[model samples]
Target: MSDSLDSLLATADVADRRDEVVTGVREHAGRIARELALLQGGDYGSRDFDTDSGTWTVKYEGGALQYLRYDGGREEVYVVSAHSPPDPEALAEALRDYAAFVEAYNAYVESLEGVLDDVDTDFPAVASTESVAAERDRVLDRIRAVSGEMAGQLHRAEGTDYGTFSARVDGTRWELKRERDQVSYLRVGGEGGIYLLSQYGNPPATDVRELVGSVPAFVEAFNERVADLDAGLSRVEL
Candidate 1:
């Protein structure tokens, strides 16, 4: 070939090589972006796209420039295109940064797993405090006060005509009877009631205050009956 022809051919070859380099580098960036998209999971929208060059995908929450994908090869391209191709060196640097970020994130997740592995499944027992003791004392004191008041009222109301004093409250029947020296009670629905023998037979107290206080079932039944002032007392008559 002539000298000029040889020179023209050489220039054409260099241009072609340059085009090839640009195309290859842009494609490499798209691959890196796709890898990032895979790691991204549900972080954003990801879709497979076919282009004149190849298929590519990129995931990002917004049109964030931080996503290193090409922009100009085809219409509505989600990745690098001819118009806004990524600088090869810059894309390489970003890929390195993304690698580091991925490594750190994975390490952080592994650290959390390690922490979980070290966790104790059994919960530690909670110790009671002075405040709890104080609260208990208050509750017992209230119960005792209520019991004393109820016993006094019942004693005043009791007469020689001790047929069974009974009341139905909240769909449950409760009966109180005077047996010689002690006043005994029975719950038609539940387990507790005064008896001559056996655990179920024990009377709450011989002393009036202790009597009402010891029988929680009686106290609860009495309280519910008396909740409506004098109306409850009237309901318990006879």
Candidate 2:
């Protein structure tokens, strides 16, 4: 019964942020069903009115709980599901849990915004001396080491050809690529560099040019810091 309901819930489009909370609710439902022997089977069902349209369906062997919110079209903003029925108290608890999960998720997103703000405010000025070139070299070396480590980790996790991993350190832009003799880029960027992993067949040069343009500002800031550090070191009497 739990397995069947879980399978169905997996197909439901729970937004990425709410997926973990919905999964937790399903687990709680399975526990309740086990205690109530609802696994024996019956057509018992119920409906509830709340922030959204809620439907609970109990099959003879198991059941499913679904919530849907629609905006007068084919699009649904929210959908969540569980595999077992809940008593009033249990339902209340589930709602509370879901609410708390939402709060935490919102907080996490806000924290990311704060991080971006900090990065923007603290970006270093680019150096204007020969030391900038030396700093670029050092930063490139660090980028290579870190990229290699990341590639090794990905290879262990996904068993794919991370071998094509390469980094191009340009002024304030650091571009990393994992390419075969093909195209289709899987790109991610952060405060350190832009990473592109591609597996699609021979793409156009335009794709590569567009990727370089999309390099994140945080990565540029990091390169600027490297240049600043090199300039500072060169002026020191050490």
Candidate 3:
């Protein structure tokens, strides 16, 4: 027979454990090596102690732990995951594609630097060097936001039964989902919504076939726009 509720409650330690403490990176790799390496090791976010990294945090709840790392003056999120964080070597290999992205990103910025020489701001829309630099920064920042998100995507693939995957790029969140009849793209924001992009006959292997294959191109295409937003400076250009 099942135990009565009163009997089950006898040993439940329901009170909050105020003495619980967390410090240091729980998963050693998968995020940026240099970035994590730079973090100050000591008690940081927890109320009870100094953590290894001032900006890192680990929270335990339900049946799992959530780890997070913040960067960019702590204004940007660097890592967020609830599953296995990949080992250092694997992460490095996965980031290989992005290494080219960095090169492309820098080349784009360098070309924009030329715009500074044309100090012809008398035109109505011609921005000042400082203004252009800020705009340049915005473009690069978008690359960073997307890259961090892609890193998370590369590591976690444990769940697929739901026929859905979601990601955030430069503050804009998007979800890719496939139902039996159609594949959909959903953008999450004030006017939250979804759009049926394509109807499918069979199960759309949307994960690797779409996400992995297309993300690099997506980054490339977005990086390409920096020129039109800034004209072709260089893959970074495309």
Candidate 4:
């Protein structure tokens, strides 16, 4: 008789819990279904809310509802199963709130993406100033090498007296004359009277390296003259 009485009481409890689940879903089913459709991923749309009992959270995972409760005394959060306390009604309300938060969050992300797509400005990397200066130095080193070699060749050639050198190439005459024991002068003429290539008085050197190092234009002119003299030296004498 005692077993029979216990069975009847358990049956009533089951019936009451079933009624509560049904009532909760019926009141919020439309909203829950709509939000679940928008909420994607295995675990998303998480939101927390305060309740008379404590704090509770709701989310969707793998197309199913999940509920969580925070225990302040333990400082830990644990899952609230459907067969547990706080009932399905509270879970539904939290789910609706969380889903709404998710909707707003997704809309904001979409708007930010649109704005980024319209940004067309491009920033390209460029060489540093030090790298550019290094490149210029390399070019200048090559120039110095060629000029020194040419000056040596001209110094040894015949008719190059007192470091005096002259050559006419492409209708332009370039001349470097050692004027005194300590000084020299550079001149250029093109169907007109010769003009000084060196703005100031020059220093004496057999290779004309001093002149080449000092004046930019003189180095180019001097190299051209040396090249012509070198070609002449290479020819077979008749």
User: What lDDT does each candidate get?
Assistant: 0.46, 0.41, 0.37, 0.49
Task: Specify the highest-lDDT model's number.
Answer: 4
**Candidate 2: worst-modelled 10 consecutive residues by lDDT:** 68-77
36-109: candidate 1 lDDT, tens digit per residue: 45555543554443343433344444322233343233322322443554444544433434434344434544
Q: List the pairs of residues colliding in candidate 3.
A: 41-52, 42-50, 42-51, 42-52, 43-50, 43-51, 44-50, 44-51, 227-231, 234-237
Lowest lDDT block of 10, candidate 1: 196-205
Q: How far is 99's C-alpha from truth in model 2 (Å)?
A: 94
Candidate 2 ranges with C-alpha deviation above 4 Å: 1-129, 162-176, 179-238
Error of 3 at 204 (Å): 57
Q: What ranking of all candidate models by TM-score puts the best one first?
A: 4, 1, 2, 3
Deviation in Å, model 3, residue 194 alpha carbon: 39
- The weakest ten consecutive residues by lDDT in model 3 span 14-23
| C-alpha lDDT of residue 17 in model 1 | 54
- lDDT score at residue 206, model 1, on the 0-100 scale: 37
Per-model TM values vs. the true structure: 0.23, 0.19, 0.17, 0.24
Candidate 2 residue-wise lDDT, 1-238, digit = tens? 9898777655244344255654675565444334234433443443222323222321112344333221212222332333333333334444543444444434544555645454556668976756645554454444445444544544554466643332334433343444332222334443433334334332233434454343444345444655676798789995
Higher-TM-score candidate of 3 and 4: 4
